[model samples]
Target chain A: MNITPNEYNEMAKKASPGTKSYKTIPAAFLVGGLICTLGQLLNNVYMDAGMSKDTASTVTSITLIFAAALLTGLNLYNKIAKFAGAGTLVPITGFSNGVVSPALEFKSEGYVLGLGAKLFVIAGPVIVYGITASAVYGVILYLFKLY
Target chain B: MSQRISKDTILLTNAPSILASAAVVGKKEGEGPLARHFDIIYDDTTLGEETWEKSESKMQKSAVEKALEKANLSSSEIQLLFAGDLLNQCISSSYGLRDFDIPFYGLYGACSTMTESLGLASLFADNGLLDYGVAVTSSHFCSAERQFRLPLEYGGQRPPTSQWTVTGSGAAIVGQSGKPPYVRGVTIGKIIDMGIKDINNMGAAMAPAAHNTIKTFLQDTNTRPEDYDLILTGDLGKVGSDLLIDLLKHDQIDLSGVHQDCGKLIYDLEAQDVHAGGSGCGCCASVLCSYILKRIQEGVLHNVLVIATGALMSTTSFQQGESIPGIAHLVYLSDSKGS
Candidate 1:
């Protein structure tokens, strides 16, 4: 109960475990690859439902994002990310985690001012530039009547 | 009234000895590579407190008490207490060390509070301002998240560049004698901003400041990178550490072999999902006290330069679209000589 500082240090050093990484990379690869496979599975399911390839791919992405957001909201995504490392982070699920995490964290500041404002704190620029480039390219193609 | 060796550098002729040091960390850090070096590791983030802020306070209190306990000295022996935290207005330190009757000087240097406080403490001791000085600093991941970024429950996807705010505390006891490792010199950093506005990427923002301080310290002390066995930066994470290496490369100063960041050394990034690595006042604070100092005591290292860097930006500043400016404080610790 009244351990001296030196004794405390020795005790803690013995009780605490060092960081182990023998299986981290393989696990990350397996989990990350599995997530991608799940995405492919969803895409195939959408195509089997008679949707076009583009539509199916988009639907699959949306589905993954939705699932990831739900997990993040339930505080389950971080747990998966913790165990899976880059497996959870490298996927579209990670993107969803990025977006939903801040929104949820800022929820206490109110919906519009807090959650809504912080919604793009991390992912704002990517979405903005991504669609902007797409729109600009689309306009250029239209000008050439490539459509 | 001390000898100024160079611009922004001080020579502590009266080498202040580190009588004792201690650290307390959270569960994640408890599982880190330096886990065994820490004094206490709480499995719970809240550390049994009602809120995260209170938990961070508890960490600081415990670290100071442990350091004092280790030195076999009472709080009364410490003439001055230099403490700080990541919280706004330094509430964590003020709230935590309230019961201690020692004269307190609260500081705020974002993540670099450890070195800032230590540097100042040694300066005070060298100037005969105090016979014994105690310095401490702390940071918690949850508390920092809620204040600087988001809440714990939020599922924000961390970027490859984002660093995990370390949940820990470190306290050091400094006096004129009674210790082997001594504080030799200090180099205070000037605020450096490369106009990086992204709050998610702190490593990039703080790297320049660290680079500047290291360059200054080397030039001021007329020492080369090879002089020290370890040249550790506080918390530049993976990205910042790389940036510092690149920045140093421009000056033709190579420290590739001996350089390491506390951010990278403290965590197993590839294993732990802490994307970039750990960053915070506690990042270097806990790591230095537990792992680095322990190595010195064991004669594993001879001289070490701890350049603790900080990104001095508030959540309000980031919200207002302001760039984050960075600062660093240097502390040279040696083992072979009487410290």
Candidate 2:
């Protein structure tokens, strides 16, 4: 069926059955609490698997990013975003989702430049700053140890 | 050129139904949607004026009546009627005001009509050329979308960057200085054309225009981001608003604290489903009339810079492979100054 722009706009004005919640405030709390619980579990699992504190944190980050990318690929992330509102955005997982979603979206434009770089446009600076700061801290620690 | 230009003062302001009904639609299939009331109503059954040729006059007449009621000035007392709309030949604004017996200055700024109209009217009012003048602009979703995008029945899913066209109208009256509220300063709008061709992606097209205009206004006026309580853009949707923020950051202009895009502020995402949000001349007009104007009157925001932007492209022109040339007009409103 050829739905027009006005028709599309009109249909959009209608509430979607998927995102509507009767007990919105409680639903928000529940969803947010569950996401946090999963994050805690992932942190424990990473430590139990023999990874150091820093390594476990990094591993959790990678795992969360991959999961978000998978959900984005399945078109489920957008749906969840609709339901959770800010809930989907509060966790480290949301940031991972943000980076991975755009990367996957631009995949069709080729891997070398499009998918590889455009995906990290918004979050790239944070990653760069993080690595640089960590390197500086590592150098400081080594010098202190020598003394 | 026809003479008889004089300064005038705005007696009243009206922006009824400019804000679309936040109808909880899917919840109830059929229910009388709540109304957003205003001072003037031209038609009991219809929204505003019927046809495009008659729309401008309808708006002008309604505005004149409202202004007259407030300022105690009759139709003959006003020297000129300055008005326009988002239409070819400005039929909606011009023809409707034809019977009002006043000189007319027809303007077309796509959606930037409100600011442009107010600016011109205020200039005349401030200069003492005319005693009272009325500036009006409007946009009908059915009329505008058909002219710019697809037909009303084309049910294509909106991209996350798309905006909804508002079916609304707004009118403001400016006169030769007034009490409490008056025209403080008018920032002349600068046109910025990024030469973006894809009308389907208005966010990319108009974002640059908005960024450029905001930058120029701040530079030319020597006003900083923190100068005004609100730095409102016309109709840049969610995507465009985000892009505009990034662009502004390049110039060391961060409006993150006190900036709001009119399109995004009017509707709720879950309720309206207006993907990127709302657009069109009506988006800014209705917003200006209903929300911003009300706040200005209530003394919530001390100073406001209303910047209305437009994607200057038609469907026929786009089909002919022409790019969308965007434009934006800026009007600074404050209670501190008189006309």
Candidate 3:
């Protein structure tokens, strides 16, 4: 009845089942690889259509984002994600979902307050950190060049 | 008069009877193992409502209406109404039962609300405070997920220990006089925190509270696990149930024989992909109001101990790195009014 929190945590750890990393890791790898391969294929196709390397890369990203958004709207992304684990997560598609999901979910609250404000609820931190880290890197690069 | 047997357990002298009960669930729950037991199973999760919150309110409203209809009483006749839901501000109960105009008591015991409300209603009836009282609670999977976890469209995999929030509602009407399946006693539980920070593993957090309450109730009543036909727990799922049996074993009590969790009972775990099992206030509420109560009414189960467990933590508290506190309330229902 008076088990310490530390003691209880240890007991609970033994009691609860953990994620099957054996299965999840492979699934994540395969799915993530497939998504990246698709992006690469799109980049090649865009380049073949007379676009430059940068344009092709940008267009490929747009295409992947569009596909992810479409899948999310159709409610297929989550089902696939359940099986794929980080396969669906550590990709451009995941970022698209992070933005689109809250936008769609909070649309019930209204366009201005709900959809707009909650648009980045999940992806906001990622964007914030990404920019902050890039700014720091840029500062370091400038200092190195001056030296 | 109802006597206090111990610090937490109370022996109800005038045993209040569960006159009528009803359960209404969504599409997923209807497709689950207890599909046939539910009174009304809506093919649409929305129940023709626009939003998931509104849908949850509609389900609660339907459950209350169905229970009242089965008892052959209107909302006006019910002296007290105890209702709650797993929503902020208890919006589902307040909005759902607004038209009834009954004196309402909105409760927020999280998932334990079903038994919490039932215990209070039984105590009020036992004390001769009211001729009729209704206890009802609900939870919606979509609504709870959006509030507590993530948006429906968010592509995130749930951990193995995670539980699916049951989209359903259950209502029970307790009267001063009725047939069998009477509320013999009640044992209120204390808050038990086990320093569990994983929100996905609610069972582990709640199992200790359940174990404490069950032990307290058995001690107060001076009865063993063998005395009851069944010991039902609310939504501990597979992981928590296993831990509960193991934890009780330390006290030289074996619950493996008669213990069953509403979480495990509600779903076909292998086929349903519900991870650990079904949870939320609606999980046990719907199961008890339908399957458990029906068996009790049919004389199949003689004595039953229902301990509904709750994880008392909010998204804010969890975000603030606070441990989840668990509570479980025990309600002893028996065919005979035991002395």
Candidate 4:
């Protein structure tokens, strides 16, 4: 009572329970590593089936995205993400879910405003920053080559 | 006549009685510990509705109907109805109760809608304005999640401090004449912000408000924690409840013995995967309408101080870097009238 905001914040911080990073970190690592390993296996399988390395890599990514979108539609991706923490998030599957979830959720609003507009709500920032950084890198590389 | 006891407390002289109450919840709540206490527990979260918003409205309607049925009165018999929900424009309450012919007042108290509406209803009944009034509020997990946080299927991890929004609704009928468990007094809370900005940790943001209201009520009533059988808080969850106990301890008022949080009571923390506990308007509303009221009616609990807390922050406000301002309204329910 009558305490400053800073004082109350300190008290609350001490009282509130924190996420157990020790458990979550390991879980994330394991699940994230497994996902990567699956991608590698899929790439190898595609290459062995006569596809080129680049095509196999592209196919692997498409397969993973499709799988993630399907899981999201089935409502299983979030449950796994809840347990796996950032493991599910730091992968292509997470990006797929980011697009698919909002698409499904906002479908009630309609095709244009709901699903079409809000399709990239979660993944929008990543795409924006990702393209921006790549474009900046490309311009720098071209300048160096010209010089 | 009802008298103003202190700065924000009002002592209801007429002592309006709670005629009947009902709680309706979704499948997850049906799996909770207090599941048996609830009147209707739908195994389907959608309740056969096409949309989650529609399902939430249906739940609220079901709760109101159940409460009216228990009171042996129809919606036409009720003079006024105060209802709200954790939705944009309080659509759940409006769309849910539109079919009813009763005069309706939609409130937006975030998670504290139940007690806010109940307090207003009790006040109106005590002042001889209405013969019967109903207070109802609701929250749906799917609806609240999509509106407040993220899409249901989004692959994001909830922090340990995050609470699950309850998919439930509760309604209570207060009459000028009924039985025990009368509405004795109410202590309206002032907004208290402790500068908590984390959307995930709403419990911490709201704990200060709960402390303020509970302290104010006790001071105004000249009573202590031991005076009441139970001092129930709305949707503070595990984190907020602990913080509330610690905050009260700073003032030499220990509440570890008699204090219970509706968030913690609704779900089995150990068994259920709910990180901190259950939250949302329905968290306390369903618990208060069912288990707490049932005990009070059965004479198991004579005196109870129900303090419903809420973090009054919207997604827009949070995005604009505003702290979550919290409020708690106290509604005193007891077996006998005060001296």
Candidate 5:
């Protein structure tokens, strides 16, 4: 087992499917569109059931998040996300996966530190910055109205 | 031969041959483009176990058994088993491989465990220390995620720079006699820290170490990027892969044509929703056993250089706000040399 580094240096493919950046446009558009369509369908169904549009939209988002979290607990969302990619991410489902994946991953650590703390590893920033930005915008609108 | 070459490289004169190898992956990996290359894919990540950790252990055990079976060998034929994982104390390897009677040497290189174990197993086989040995490693998305990051039930978001820990196991059997694609040598790396503390950004943390290892290997061996048909890095993902190129270019070494990262190869960026691609010990292990070794066996590739890289960071270290340390190990696998 003795030799030269130069020999090792001499040692050393087609872009195998996994190595190269995969072509994901069709899958992304198709999956993303399908999820949105599903949301629309759910909204229509809720409206037809006599719920207001605003309430139906909110309920639809809540249902998607609930479904995503449930799937995450069953360890199915990651599988779907794998196939859908941006399709899953662009929709509300992606955000739900973001929140659920880490929480599920951290279950063994304990409730306080693992589940409660790490629950927002992905979406925490979005919630924080998102709420902050909205509040700032609200204040600006209020000032503008007064002027 | 005494087995010492330059500062970090070891040349194996006897050149142990890889008789067979097997890759067992989770459902997500099974859906990837190289699905056909894998030997087994589990629909259930837990492999029917009560917990993900136990399931990962079962996966490792199955992978080793499958590899030996493919080689037409039995447990008695293997003298030692070199295995590891990204779990605490390498439990995925220890508990998984415990049933086997072979002498066990558990290793830890985080994602680079594949090359680290391969290097050791090759050293033992090539030097006549053993007639045969198995180099195996595994990482589970759930098991590793829970142990290394957070609980599975916790709702959290992963940053764009983060990589998905692959759930898979790969085992390779190296014996005194076999076909080509022999183990030529290894360049064991030294730990390097460039003061990168972001656990989410492995590419930034590990790129410098890869550069250091590659430079050492090149200088010690007096070889250029053109010498090898392929230069593969383990789990550098896209960002780290780019950084490796830029760092090497500073030394006038361009790896544009030959370099590929296993992390970048294992998942789709957009379609798979893998931000920086795949990581963990299984990232390099599964891909190397399936794709790279398959091509070499087909004679599509002559000589190849595989430098598996690892980020030596733990949840404790990150929690303490310590900069991550990185290492890279080089192994030369060639199809033409012995033949």
Candidate 6:
């Protein structure tokens, strides 16, 4: 895209480096932090539901993915995505949730080439590396035990 | 076409045509963020407008009332109402202004609404039919989020490139060549599509459109960078704003001393947690309502150009494998003396 010199001239004023109020700083920080805290609380809730550490982690992931998937489908998740800042992200659940939401969103286009394929558009590599790395790690641990 | 007075001109320039103007802020009530920002309180909470369908109507009516009060005009005096919003139906702007006593036109231009409204309003003003006209635009965090990415209660993280939609609305009243702050020059934006498909990153999607429009405006007007006091882009936040500077360098144009992206100017990325910046029509409009107009009142700026950028993509459009197409409009504000 190109811009004219006159347009550049018009934009110069009011373009100075400025500062926001001190009040807004803390409020945004607190709100964003609170959202993250809730994610941690959800993980704790899953742990106390009679699940082992490993199972609890899996359940948490599943819960995040499913909840995000539903919201993505209903077009509600994007609203929270706007506010709450990294609270909606940062968590491991955010990854799968991101992947599944986009895929499910495009599902109506047809399953074979659409749903099945697009489901991994963003995180396909992560899933691939995840299984591969876990298998390799398990073998290494077993060999150490044998030694 | 006589150069004399015109009825069409009166219909176009009047502020009575204003249907509605609504603002939705993200801050909880009584908690003012930017003291120097705008002269209004921010609403911090989830907003469910009874039904999503009625949201725009509710916002527009309220905004129009506020604008009318400020302009000291009545709705019956309006001949046409031009409005826009972030939603598909422009529900917040359209439905909000539906029952008004005037013809209605709806537009969707993402965050560059102030320029869009001014540009369109000026057209009617220049045409010599309208007397009073009003242009309004709006956005809401809760509404836009649910429609675009996640639910209000859904806990998800945003990438570094994501821009926060300013939860607010802004309205402007244009009349038949009256008063100090009047519509002056308008640069119609051309569609610039760079084939970028990631709707998640709007700055990249819109930077080219803004850059292209700015380039065109300068060429068409035969003006240089120094002619105006400032050149503003609609919503290209920090990352995209930097990229624009780099791109301008290639064109042998230096905007180092005079450039601002509304998204960047509206909020502090670190403080607001808006990664790239704020992207919404309100980003530009609110800043103008709060800052630029005040400066104009104070005579700090002589000539100003407001260019609003838009990412022409919807949730459905992006999901369908369509690349984002961008557009921008340029409106020039100058002194009546033309010096």
lDDT of 4 by residue, B1-339 (tens): 788979899999999999999999988889989989999999999999989999999999999999999999978899999999999999999999999988999999999989999999999999999999999999999999999999998987888889999999999999877588899999998999999999999999999999999998999989999999999999999999999998899888999999999999999887888988999999989999999999999999999999988999999999999999999999999988767
User: TM-score of every model?
Assistant: 0.75, 0.60, 0.98, 0.98, 0.74, 0.68
Kindly indicate the candidate among 1 and 5 with the higher lDDT. 1
Candidate 5 is graded, for docking, as incorrect
TM-score of chain A, model number 5: 0.81
DockQ of predicted candidate 1: 0.12
> What digit string (tens of lDDT, one per residue) describes model 2 on residues B1-339?
112211211211311111111111111111112124344433321334444324434544454465466556677876776677677777767666778888889888887787787777766766667766777666655556545653332212344556776555666666644443455554555555555665655655677667776777677656798988998988887766776786688788998888898777766754767777777666676667656776777788777878888887776788899777777777777755522
Where does model 6 exceed 4 Å of error? A1-147, B1-24, B28-37, B44-48, B51-57, B337-339
Candidate 4 C-alpha lDDT tens digits along A1-147: 767889889988887788889999999999999999999999999999999999999999999999999999999998999889899999999999999999999999899999998998989999999999999988998989853
Model 1 chain A poorest ten-residue lDDT run: A8-17
CA lDDT for candidate 2? 0.62
| Better candidate by TM-score, 1 or 3 | 3
Clashes of 2: 27
Candidate 5 C-alpha lDDT tens digits along B1-339 = 436868788888887888889999999999887789999999988799877889999999999999999999999889999999998888889999888878999999878889999999999988789888999999999887777775554434466678899999899999777687788888998897777776877876777778888888888878898988999999988878877787687788999899999888888777887888899899999999888899999999988889888999989889899888988888899996443
TM-score of each model's B chain? 0.98, 0.81, 0.99, 0.99, 0.98, 0.87
Q: Residue by residue across A1-147, what tens digits does model 2's lDDT show?
A: 133334423332331122234555455577668877877788899899998988887887788777766776777765776566556666666676667765664554579685787667646776899899999988998989843
Which ten residues in a row are the worst by lDDT in model 1 chain B?
B150-159
lDDT over C-alpha atoms for residue A5 of model 2: 32
lDDT of 1 by residue, B1-339 (tens): 356898889978777778899999999999989888899998987878876788999989999999999989999888999999999999999999999998999999989999999999988987889888899999999889889875565433466678899999999998878466788888988998776777877887888889889998898888899999999999998878887787777787898988999999888997887878999999999999888888887889989999999999998899899988999999988885432
Compared with the true structure, all predictions reach lDDT values of 0.85, 0.62, 0.93, 0.94, 0.83, 0.65
Candidate 2 ranges with C-alpha deviation above 4 Å: A1-147, B1-37, B40-64
Output the number of the lDDT-best candidate.
Answer: 4
User: Which of candidates 1 and 3 reaches a greater lDDT?
Assistant: 3
In the order shown, the candidates' DockQ scores are 0.12, 0.01, 0.86, 0.84, 0.12, 0.13
Candidate 5 wrongly placed segments (more than 4 Å) = A1-147
Best by DockQ: 3
- Candidate 6 lDDT at B19 equals 24
What's the CA error at residue A30 for candidate 5, in Å? 23
